[model samples]
Target: MSRYFPHPAYAEDQPLARTILITHVGTRAITTGTIIGAGIFGTREALRRLRKAAAPSTVTASRSQLYLRVAGHSTLWTIGIVSLGLAGRMWGREEIEWQDRSWRLMENEAQLQTDDWTYGGMVAGLAATALFKRPVGWVAAVGSVGAGSVAGTLGYLGWRYGLQRREPPISE
Candidate 1:
């Protein structure tokens, strides 16, 4: 039985499992960092845009009026950041869970090799996005890269799992 069902022991010896676990952690870290960075930088940019749009007199308005403006902007920024962070965290967790499950079930070494390339591309995309100075550009770039990577990974998992299910079982 152990000879026929050697996957458990093989998994224990394989570094792929550990690497996948580390990848999950890295994904979570990247998600958190991106969310927090976007929130802080985006809020600052939004406030700057608001100030720029205001009339010259508004810039020198009464202290009470200035305080009100600041409070309003801050409230909006806080809400936006919280919403974005929560959504990003939820999505990231789901993605990690899906990947973990997929990798556990995957037996195709070729598919795993393909995943390495796909993940490398994603990291490169993130680096490219991070180079942008503007918050909007950064957010757009990162969001697109993240979304594309998630979609591609899920698609690959689905294809592999579907193929595995369609194959006839071995009877030894």
Candidate 2:
């Protein structure tokens, strides 16, 4: 009997799907790591704040309040992680277009350079946000990350185009 579905080798050749899968996995991993790291670092302070603010009538009440706060925070983190994962998956589609159009290559010096800049920008933004605290800080942090990614993309495009222009034409 003939098979109804294409061979597994055909699926393996689809770079776009592979890129999206990798991006989704990477986003989830990063989000999970960040959530865990934050919990480990800030749980004590968070619990303390909850206790102080609630001024519960009894020990059990305070404990319950703490549990609620933790649960709420965990829920928020989970939502954020899922949102980021979805966004990453969507972004991967644009990346696949860039790859298909020869705008960027998966494993190349230009791509590496662009990634470095993008990550550096994100780190810098997050650091600024953490240091400044609230209101203006969050906005600035987001702006910085956006600016950084745009700058990196533009730089990569310029480099690619410049290299192309500099190449000598082949003689027939």
Leading candidate by lDDT: 1
Model 2 stretches astray by more than 4 angstroms: 1-104, 137-140, 148-172
Error of 1 at 66 (Å): 26
Q: For all candidates, what are the clash counts? A: 0, 0
lDDT, residue 103, candidate 2: 22
List, residue by residue over 55-99, the lDDT tens digit for candidate 2.
446654333234333433443465467767656755646554533
Give the per-residue Cα lDDT of candidate 1 at 16: 48
lDDT (Cα, tens digit) per residue for candidate 1, span 48-149: 788886535635444323332343343344445655665575554645464444355444454454455446545665565445444434335555354334
Query: Which regions of candidate 1 deviate over 4 angstroms?
Result: 1-16, 53-123, 126-172
Backbone clash total, candidate 2 = 0
Give per-residue lDDT, candidate 2, residue 13: 39
